[model samples]
Target: MNEVAILCVDDETVILESLQEQISRHFGEQFMYEAAESAEEALEIIEELNQEGVKIVVIVSDWLMPGMRGDELLVKVHQQFGDITTIMLTGQADEKAIERAKREANLYCCIHKPWRKEELLKIITTALESV
Candidate 1:
C-alpha cells in the first residue's frame, strides 16, 4: 500500500523539527511524516508524493512565513487536492485569513503557536479519524 503522509510546513527549522518529532513519536510507522520550510517547497513535495501514489492525509502549516502565508497555501492545496485535511498552526494570523481558510480550504482546525502537545495531537487524531 502507498504510505499516507502528514506534511508540516513552517519557516522555522526548530518548529518543523519539533513537529516531526512529536508526530513520529505518537504515530510511529502508521503514517509518513514530511516537512517543508516554505509553501512553494511544500507544494512541490506534495506533487511529487502524489505522483508516487502516496496519499497526503493532512497538512499542518504555520500562518506567518517568508512568502505565501499558510492560509493561501492551504487554499491552493484545497483547490488541487480537496480531500486532504488542513490545520493552521500560527502565532500571528489575522481573523480574516483564518476565515478565508475555513471557507476556501476546508480547514480542519487552527491551533495557535506554543500549542499544547496534547491539543495538537488530539486535533490531528480527530482529523485522521474523519478521513
Candidate 2:
C-alpha cells in the first residue's frame, strides 16, 4: 500500500503541536503526520513527500500566517495536486477568503479556530473515505 500523509500548518508552534497530538491520538499510525510553521515550509514538505511517493491526502492550515495565507496555500496545492484535499482551520479568515478557497481550491471544508476535536476527526475521516 502507498504511504499516506496528513499535513497541518500553523504559524503558532503550540497550535501545531496540539493539532499533531490530537490527530496522532485519534488516527494512531494510520497516517504520517507533518507540521509546518509556514506556508512556504509546508509547500517544501509537500514536494519532498511527493518525490518520495508518500501521498498527502489532507492539509489543514491556518489563514493568518506571515507570508502566504491558508487560502492561497490551498489554492496553490490544489493547482499542483488536485487530488489532495485541503481544509482551512483558522480564527481570523474572512468570509471572502473562505469562499475563495472553496471556489478555487475545491477545499474540502472550513473549520473555525478552537475547533471541536470530534468534529475535526469526523471531517478528516470523511475526507479519507472519499480518497
Among these predictions, the greatest TM-score belongs to 1
The prediction achieving the highest lDDT against the true structure is 1
- TM-score of each model, paired residue for residue: 0.98, 0.97
Compared with the true structure, what per-residue lDDT tens digits does model 2 show for residues 1-131?
Answer: 44999999999999999999999899998889999999999999999999999999999999999999999999999999999999899999999999999999999999998999999999999998998
Deviation in Å, model 1, residue 56 alpha carbon: 0.4
Candidate 1 clashes between residue pairs 3 or more apart in a chain or in different chains: none
Worst 10 residues of 1 by lDDT: 1-10
Number of residue pairs clashing in candidate 1, backbone atoms closer than 3 angstroms, sequence gap of 3 or more or interchain? 0
| Model 2: residues with Cα > 4 Å off, grouped in runs | none
Cα deviation at 51, candidate 1, in Å, is 0.4
- Candidate 1 on 1-131: residue-level lDDT in tens? 43899999999999999999998899889988899999999999999999999999999999999989999999999999999999999999999999999999999999999999999999999999999
**lDDT, residue 40, model 2:** 100
State residue 8's C-alpha deviation in candidate 2, in Å.
Answer: 0.3
